[model samples]
Target chain A: MARFNLGITDVRKITGALTEKGYPDFAGYALMSLKLSLEKIISNHGFKESGAMVSRIYSDDNFTDSLIDELSVETTEMFRDPSMWRLLRERIFPGIFGTGDKIKFWLPGSVSSEDLVSLIILLKESDLTTRSAIILTSLSGKSLDNIASGVFRSSKMEVSEANYTKFQGKGELSEYMVKEGGKFFWNKNLFSEVTFSLGKSHLEASATCVNCIIFRDKMIYMNLTLSNKMLDVICRSLSGGGYFIIGSGESLTHTLFDKHFSQVDQNEKIYQKIR
Target chain B: MYKAIIIGGSAGSFQVVTRILSSLHKDFPLPVLLSLHRLKHIRSGFVEALSLKSSIPVKEPGDKDHIRPGIAYLAPSNYHMLIELGSRFALSTAAPVNHSRPSIDLSFFSAAQAYREKLIGIILSGANRDGAQGLERVASLGGKTIVQDPDECQVPVMPKESLKLTGVDHILNSSQIIEFLKKINRNALD
Candidate 1:
């Protein structure tokens, strides 16, 4: 019900640009981007008194980068949703790891590398680390490298420990990290089995059918069309009977891929790929 | 010596924080910590812009940075910011709470552990019930708790939910928040 004060031409022009840029849901994205740009421009220019200028700048792309950056929520944590990990360990992994002939685990859109690391820890605890190959792919090359480096903020140890306890983790979370001058550094040995790569979701690439594919919390940013397309890609990337996991808040109910993937653990957001 | 003040906001929050920061004096004594729901892909120029708009210094919190008075620290775009008792600020790449990273709950819970009775927790405009449990934790630990007036907030779910969960010390609008902060500071100074 929010009314945009922008002219029709401005709206059309912005919409066209976003559409041409391969954004499937142009209108919603444009509206959100415009709102964020308006706020940033008004505040930065100290033009609080100039409402007209604020409206005019809303549709402009000059502040697009900054606005998008501010609006994007890249918050993720290690072993987040420990229950999901618990389900993966106790229920999912026992079946998958039992086959254990060089299992491949993939995490698409792996931001900051926490979830991927969490998977690695779970794999290690399950005695599947030596036999598994972990692949972490993200658009941000920097984040990929950071994951490969295996460094983490020391302050996270407490919650990570709590999460470990919640999952009934056998070993100490502290055993995986070392304190270095107030910073908690993750053990590099964990990464000895992980492969970090930079890749976009829409790109044409090939990944062998893996044991599991964890794409938690990435689909909410995309529109239904893009989400469907991504889901198609995910289904193709996942091997037969492999696992696919997503954020509990996100649903694939409307997507065509839903029928192809059967829910293994609904509350834990885990699904198994079927024909 | 002033302790930290933790503020949480989500949907419809940009304006709320702006108003609160605009109302406060530049010399506000306590170290202010903020956790706003934001995407990880975005480059946060939020602190710089907010610092320019307000009288106080604003910066995205760095790992182990000491919490200094008169400066405002924001949880980084993708990380949760926490306060340690020795006036140190810690940042973490922890999992999302209530489906949000840089969660108000994470910061508030960490501050409760670090500052205990000295903490002042505030829940402002947001779409979800993220800060409700965190505020309860604060109150249980004898920390001061405040919720933005649900009637006045751009998004009232957070404050309203917090109210439902526990008894808050105050429910005020952005305009009155400055006065409340000043009153608390005066009591500490006294």
Candidate 2:
């Protein structure tokens, strides 16, 4: 399949078509990013053109989920940014443990299984596996299933192992995995206590509260309007004095909710809700 | 008139980048976006080193940060910097392309689409062919393309690859690259 560029006009048209078909409104995504994603999705899926891709997405729910998965970009690796994990282990987790309440974490949207597996390892190492509860949600059921399975590509292991070294894990990351048919699969029991939900609306509908909300790197794809809307939901879900971690290159400083949180770690983009 | 300038380089392009940034007019009229390969783990020093002689302020833009004139935005380590529709920056943690996270091709691809004929893309010295396809996209989009003269490059592989891929608007050495930018600035001002 030959690669083709999706111009801004094409992006807007596809976004409109998908939303009209009852798919989530992705019109708020950054146009250039969406354009590139659409281009790749078309080429990778061998869609002869954008119109056919859109038609298939409109008719097939599973294909739409796959498209969402691709658009979200599966780039996360285990223990990504080891310093952040180290900080969580050495300082943040201990502080949360001191609150004398069960620790809860909410990861909204289609977070990668690598991230979930990494968190489970952290919990096990800290001996807090039974004391913490995690809520994971995504627009795609396939993504939720992926998180539950805990299988990941071996290609990412090299970088992940290096990150684990920097994170100073108690044992090698490989020690926690069973290699099967060239893929690394973690024990599914590690997520035995996790709660899985279908979409972002689940967080709001349940009025779920969390001790920390890890919604990192996902907002860069959203426009300011959608970002702020999601921030409102995140702020509501986070209890006062709770932690909010984001991507290092992302900032809440310009958002409408900046006044509600104070920066705890500038370089790591960690924030604490003051109100 | 050029709305922005993007330069992609790796390996031996640091000194070349520093030279160009140092000599660019302090009030340069367009935003400068840079995607240079760097050590992912050691993040604090590259900006400081580049800013040492730069008359214009250099920064690593946070995700969604709005683009501004006269400022040079360096792609953050471990992320792909993309130009968004609203003239803001969008950083992605997508897997590295061509074994590089701050892949020059990814940056140039997005910028060419966003700015079209108003964009200026330049590929500098590097040891890989990461920016070759990107220069081709820029040329196809009607954006101006440039490559550091391969003969003058410390590692001629990148520029040579770009030249092989696209007919760039200019093949300039270090000083000539600066002169070209200054000329663009002067034209914008006039």
Q: lDDT of all predictions, in order shown? A: 0.69, 0.84
Residue-wise C-alpha lDDT for candidate 1, range B1-190, written one tens digit per residue: 4387999999887887877677676677788889888865344467777776777878875444567888888887655665644566545443466877677876786677567788899999999988887788788788999888999888889999899888899998877886888776677667
lDDT of 1 at B45: 69
DockQ of 1: 0.05
DockQ of all candidates, in order?
A: 0.05, 0.64
Candidate 1's displacement at residue B91, Å, is 23
Candidate 1 vs. true structure, TM-score: 0.53
Candidate with the greatest lDDT versus the true structure: 2
Which docking class does model 1 fall in? Answer: incorrect
Query: Model 2 misses residue A57 by how many Å?
Result: 1.0
In order, the TM-score of chain B in each prediction is 0.92, 0.98
Would you estimate the TM-scores of all the predictions?
0.53, 0.95
Write model 2 residue lDDT over A16-94, tens digit each, in one string.
Answer: 8777765544877766667777887888888777888878867888887777767777487788788888888888888
lDDT at residue A7 of model 2 (Cα atoms): 64
